[model samples]
Target chain A: MWRGFSMRVVSAFLIGLLFGLGLVVSQMINPAKVIGFLDIAGDWDPTLLVVMAAALATTFLGYRLVLKRGKPVLDASFRLPTNTVIDRPLLIGAGLFGVGWAMAGLCPGPAISAAAVGGPAPWIFVAAMACGMQGQRLIRP
Target chain B: MVEFTPLSGAVGGFVIGLAAVLFMAVNGRVAGISGILAGVLTPVRGDWAWRAAFMAGLFAAPLAFWLATSEKPQVVFDHPLWLVALGGVLVGFGARLGGGCTSGHGVCGMARLSRRSIAATATFMATAMISVFVLHHLAGF
Candidate 1:
């Protein structure tokens, strides 16, 4: 039991490390780079497009191979998202996220990763994000 | 205009995908940053441990890179503190309500060819582009 728990924790840490490294290396942690990509009406940067395409392609092939296994190594079943309905919450929420993303040029992954830099902005953003999340729970729950 | 770095982008993206695949293989979990983070905020029994470990790793990546390379990753925020805070709130709330963010919906869910993810991605991407246009061009911010 201990072995299984440790394995999951270690694997998760390593994977998160790799993901954060990718964000840093790709310059996705830079708000300027993200804004440059989103500002198509201005001096648009196509780098993010390449990044997205490459990520999608790699994940496309990688997930296919991974899912072929009957079960994960440490877990009994894949905990994949099962909700299929493209409902109101999905659209509204995505829309809100998009606007916020453009306003700040940061997403969840990069935002959290950026916290390592130890600045007021990232921390403030993260703290506000936490509050917003908690607020949502308060409202919904 | 932002400097284009296709090679680094692709490499980083591939690494990100690999991490996602590895996470799924070991823990059978999607590497969704928002969901993982939300789980951390609201701890559940027998969970949250791996999530905390993963977040810790994410927080460590930039420090690790800086230690190894003596260079901190660039992070710039053009928006004001209030705007950034508002954006953070929106991102946090929207990601939860939407059930995923860029990493979950854009990367993992799209890779799996999920229709809901596709729609969510489309909505977010389009709105983000529009928001950028408005902010950078129309509003001249």
Candidate 2:
């Protein structure tokens, strides 16, 4: 059991590292850059849309590739979401997230991705994100 | 110079999704940043190693980018700290309520085309627009 947990940790770390690396390579780690596109006050930064499109395409193709093989890279099977339909939680969460993104121009991936870049604001953003998660745990149900 | 093709974004996204899927297969966990960070607050003795390593990779990737480009990308945040804090809390709340952050659902889950993630990502995107509209347009803050 312990070994299994350890393996999982290793897997999670690699995934996260790749995720972070992607952010850097895509230049999403820089909020000024992100906001610059969103700014619309000057020359818009259309670069993010390009990055997002590329990411979407890759994931789309990846799913097609992986679905063919049942098992995953590690010990477990692919844990795809069982639900196929959209619901209220989905709507609410997206609305909230979009609001946050528009306000900050730094979504969770980049917020945490760019944490080490160091601005009191990003750290504060991360702190609230954690606290929000903790607050959820505190809520019953 | 190498052609400045937009394909790099797609390639980067593909890599991130593929990396995450691989990591999940091996690790048996969702690549949720909120959960990972939450794990750190009340951590188990041995658990710390992987979490720390994971976080280290997140921060270190930029250095790798710098090494490759020989240019440290400029990082900036134009928003005030208070708004940043507000936005962060909302993301945290949304993640907790929905049970995953953008990396977990938007990047990883959406890659697999999971409905939950799709829904979550959609909501996340929408809320971002609304938030921005409110801040820049309505609230005028």
The best candidate by lDDT is: 1
Which 10-residue span in candidate 2 chain A carries the lowest summed lDDT?
A35-44
Q: Local error of candidate 2 at A82, Å?
A: 2.9
TM-score of candidate 1 against the unseen true structure: 0.97
Give each prediction's DockQ, rounded to 2 decimals.
0.82, 0.46
Model 1, B60-126: lDDT tens per residue?
8888888999988888888788878888998898888888899999999999999988998999999
lDDT tens readout by residue for model 1, A1-141: 989999898989989999999888888888888999998878778878888888889888988999999999999899988889999989998999898888888889989888889488988889988887888788776
TM-score of chain B of each: 0.96, 0.80
Chain A TM-scores in order: 0.96, 0.84
* Superposed Cα RMSD, model 2: 3.9
- In candidate 2, position A118 carries an lDDT of 54
